[model samples]
Target: MSISSAAPPKPTQVLPYATKDLHEVYTLGTKLGQGQFATTYLCTHNTTGETYACKSIPKNKLLFKEDYDCVWREIRIMQHLSELPKIVKFHDAYEDSFFVHLVMELCEGGELFDRIVQKGYYSEQEAVKLVKNIVEAVQDCHSLGVMHRDLKPENLVFDTVEDDADLKIVDFGLSVFYKPGEIFSDVVGSPYYVAPEVLNKHYGPEADLWSVGVISYIILSGVPPFWADTEKGIFAQISHGILDFQSEPWPVISDSAKDLIRKMLDRNPGKRFTAHQVLSHPWIVDDNIAPNKPLGV
Candidate 1:
């Protein structure tokens, strides 16, 4: 998890892709997930009879070869972590004529977003549990210098069951590594979750915290904190820092929880709390300390 200042900012070579390692004749089952750049399939290991989520990133859609390079970074980041129970496991990467195939842990649990909408809103206790686990996972990512630019609930998957379940952080397409003093300038991420600085083309890991705030709001209420009539309206609201709590729809959430959200959504990155700090907040630590409860506050 130590940051290496001397290492190159980004790796060049496409992390070696081996097709033979992935047994052939493996049938591609139903779709698992899809994004702008990749399509995921549920596939079984031909020999071991094990299941995996295989993500195919088409080279053509990789606007620049750098996108392919990012895939390598994602591989390296995933490989270095060994096995973080909360983070999705990356098994292997290979290439076909049309795309690069990434074999990853198959999580059958549907998106957290669907669950949120289905239930209208999560109970305070349930929210605490999910948030705590997510914060712990983010802390792990920060320790490794990997920042997940997009961290919406859709990217968080539950393996099955609600209590003591493994919530895997999936999708690293927009992930990046930053060494000390390294400043990243990329205006990327979903509109609702993106930080204000991101819209202005200036951001760092704190931006991810902003996304976490948006998610917390969604978990407490059934909708995002910032909604707009149009994309421009949404961007303006985010840019102007116009996040207001809806008094009526707001659940019986703790005051500490609301304060934590405010701290995370702070417009100034300097004022925002780091993942580690957020994890230690009273709302997360004192009020809710179940063995593996979600950090609700």
Candidate 2:
């Protein structure tokens, strides 16, 4: 008897949500940005000549079922939250044999920190406004049963270069849908912004507030509260959850702002301030408290 080789397994579809081919609708242009699994490009509509940002995720990059699921979840989450003014609007999704493309609103103003640096002036009032927008977006996400697992200054982008341009939350790659009281075990999120509960491998939506607190701290002091040379050292510092208020800018920072940060950065998730509470806090609600003095480092 002759031995016969078995047939190769069929490849699974990477995007069940995409029905059309991306090339047929939009012409891909210059590259905008690149991430681990996707490369964002400037794309123009073939028919209307309108411009948009396209995030093209290669199928080959998705080596596992979980990777495909993550991309799917990201698409769905963006679609679900597109109506919110603070979120980057999702236009459509498309797929071919090799790649999945997500078309979204083009934000030309760039990252939050870059815009701040370009302006040449930073103040508590400006930081308060930025935090208010962030917290409000987080509140909306939580209310919609979505948890933005990753929240940081780099993910915040402006729609235009205008001084009054709208700041939008651009990346939702790590976002997930959650039910009340749901707990997640994944240790996900950027260093210096990850919550203590997250490092413990047990956390919820409140972890987002911790990230906002870290961003707010950086905005105020021009430095992260927890800083180290390596990722491991940063994680260790974050796990300790010790905030430096005695540093250069902290003494000059407002008391109410510090209070809010303390509450948001609480090691225990239960004690952390809720999105609503952060929005309702005196510093956020009272404009007089946040001074116009430049907080440049």
Candidate 3:
């Protein structure tokens, strides 16, 4: 959709958050966050006063045709997932001469990674609740032919700080629609959480589940199962690294939890459990475990 330029608002000179590339429908608030290609700001509706987050990306920075199309793809993907549960809600978007503005639901609880760091850890029971929500989101995405190329704790956010808050998966910049068995060649994702097949540049939706495995390991241990001092070492570890479960915290972790990770992190992508399969895993489906135990150390 194109922006309507029907009537220019008078007193345009003093327009706050108004640019040729953005609309005055949103009144800019405090700065929320910034990233490589865009900066997010808290915004409010001019008439409704409802809060939202506006991602402002400079159009000039899109030097290549692919870069421009990538943004549009993100918009389309978000539109497709507009009503999906456990996902950040997308409102609408606008483009002016300078930037593309994508308005999304404002999440107040911040990143799941921050919670993991601050709380020291979560029990398998607690982690199960979180992972189940995430896997369901992923399963939904896959069902719709969407592949979240980048899946990590950093992209997971909570709707609020409440214990029962919904854990929503956000960000779709690297996401794409792919059919089952289709392959992708471009390498994309955070180094630590990427699947081994992603490094090989030939992978499908199962690659995302591998990242889920990495996230599962992190949620239970407060540390990634694989790590290295350098990027090369990290990649080496991902390709042939031994998942460390013999250390301190592993003894206390339930075997079911470890087994879940093992199946997802398997080197062979073909053998990795899909998101739907993960939901039925013993670790995720068992809600009868004893009270939540802290495994943060």
Best-fitting candidate, scored by TM-score: 2
Top model number, lDDT: 2
- Backbone clash total for model 1 is 9
Quote the lDDT for 238 in model 1: 85
Candidate 1: clashing pairs of residues: 128-294, 128-295, 128-296, 129-293, 129-294, 130-294, 131-295, 132-294, 132-295
Locate the minimum summed-lDDT window of 10 residues in model 3.
Answer: 7-16
Can you tell me which runs of candidate 2 are displaced by over 4 Å? 1-11
**How many collisions per candidate?**
9, 0, 1
Rank the candidate models, highest lDDT first. Answer: 2, 3, 1
- Between prediction 2 and prediction 3, the one with superior TM-score is 2
How much does each candidate deviate from the true structure in C-alpha RMSD?
Answer: 6.8, 3.5, 7.3
Alpha carbon lDDT of residue 220, candidate 1? Answer: 69
Give the per-residue lDDT of model 2 (tens digit) for 112-182.
99987888768899888889988988898998999888899889999999988888998899999999999
Candidate 3, residue 112: how far the Cα is off, in Å: 0.4
lDDT of 3 by residue, 1-297 (tens): 998776433221211244343456888899988889899999999879999999888877777666777888898999999799788999988877677888999998889878767666567788888888889989989989999999998799988887788989888999999977789999999989998899999999998899988998888777888899998888899999898888878888888888888999999988889887888887887777523777744
